[model samples]
Target: MKTLILTTAALALSAGAALAESHAQTVRLGTEGAYPPYNFLNDAGEVDGFEREVGDELCARAELTCEWVTNDWDSIIPNLVSGNYDTILAGMSITDERDEVIDFTQNYYPPAASAYAAPSEDVDLTGGVVSAQATTIQAGHVADSGAALLEFATPDEAVAAVRNGEADAIFADKDFLVPIVEASGGELVFVGDDVPLGGGLGVGLRESDGALRDTLDAAIQSMKDDGSLNELIVKWFGEDAQTFE
Candidate 1:
């Protein structure tokens, strides 16, 4: 009887462990509320954008609930490292500099960085001038080229600066800038061909959370396969702006 009781207790413990391992809950996602059409707070202060939509779909597909926390762009990665959030749904490009600190899931969206100028400005495209935010990869591309570089704390500010003639051009990821341009009426125009910025936005996970990353990656892959990603892109970016590969 003692042996049988001990065996039963061991089985119960094993079952409990299995259940714990299978039902991880409540993934906390982080985003910068400043970047629109990706992840930003709407007028109602609720998160609404492409990334938020995709993140919600992913969470549902993965059978997990998520709570989004807003953090500054510069602090998002650091906060993730410190356990302030589990993943970043912000439209963060996967760059080597960032890769050195955190792990990213497979790219979910491709982005082209392009420079824009006010419609009235005669930007010399023949000169191949590129304006980019100083801290971004786009800036690095033109850092040594002596191109007209205009930097700003946020993409919105950069767009505004261009509209106000503070700068002749503004460079940014295509996905983030397209909507802003449309909303600005005839204030801006693309100055050059869109440049392929390597690395698409992906969910950021801690190095220790490989399992969670794998789960989210699978869900994202499924979304891509079923045309859900394209649908979301079109919904946010308009019919002609949809681009997926």
Candidate 2:
């Protein structure tokens, strides 16, 4: 009877472990709902963009179901730390500062930033215009050029400010800004060569979650190998602009 009871207890522990592992498979994804061509809300109030497509592919490849959560850009990292979500699919750059707080998956995209100005405006961004997002690395590249820096609450606001003549130009990731420019009916134009925005977008997870991070990184690699990443970029930003390498 003692032997039988011990065997039953072992089976029960094994079953519990299996259940726990199964429960740990889902990956919760987070994104900022405003940055278009990356992750933004559409007319139907659905969150659809480049990052969303990538997130879907990642989940499929990892054989995990993803639950996407949308929040303001500023709140993304905070919420990730606070357990609001497990991963950030937002176009979040993998900067060193961010790495100190969260573990990032292998980079899924490349560094690409640019400045956009009103088409009719004669702003010479070549002279260096400070970026409005001060924490962004681009701010250092153009901080001292006296090129008229404008502050904005969000990327959309920055683009609108330029469109309405409130600001001469706005700096943003090419993947995010290019779509806005093309959709703006020739109102905005690229001001200069694309700048290297340190760190491209990646899946963000807590530093403790090494296993989950590995799974996401593998999924991203699979997507790149199968051409899904390139296809999505071209679908959103045209063939010429799909430069993710």
| lDDT, each prediction | 0.72, 0.70
lDDT of 2: 0.70
Q: Model 1 compared with the native: what TM-score?
A: 0.81
How far in Å is the alpha carbon of 237 misplaced in model 1?
1.7
Clashes of each: 0, 0
Q: How does residue 154 of candidate 2 score in lDDT? A: 70
TM-scores of the models, in the given order? 0.81, 0.80
Question: How far in Å is the alpha carbon of 87 misplaced in model 2?
Answer: 0.7
Candidate 2 has its poorest 10 consecutive residues by lDDT at 11-20
Error of 2 at 171 (Å): 0.9
lDDT per residue for candidate 2 within 1-245, as digits (tens), equals 64664454345444434443687755678888777777888898878988888888777656676788887776778889999888988777788888999999878876656555455556776553434554454444456456666655577776677767666677777766766777888877777567776677678899987767766676666566557787887787677764545
The residue-by-residue lDDT of candidate 1 on 116-165, one tens digit each, is: 55555577533444455546666666565466666666667767776676
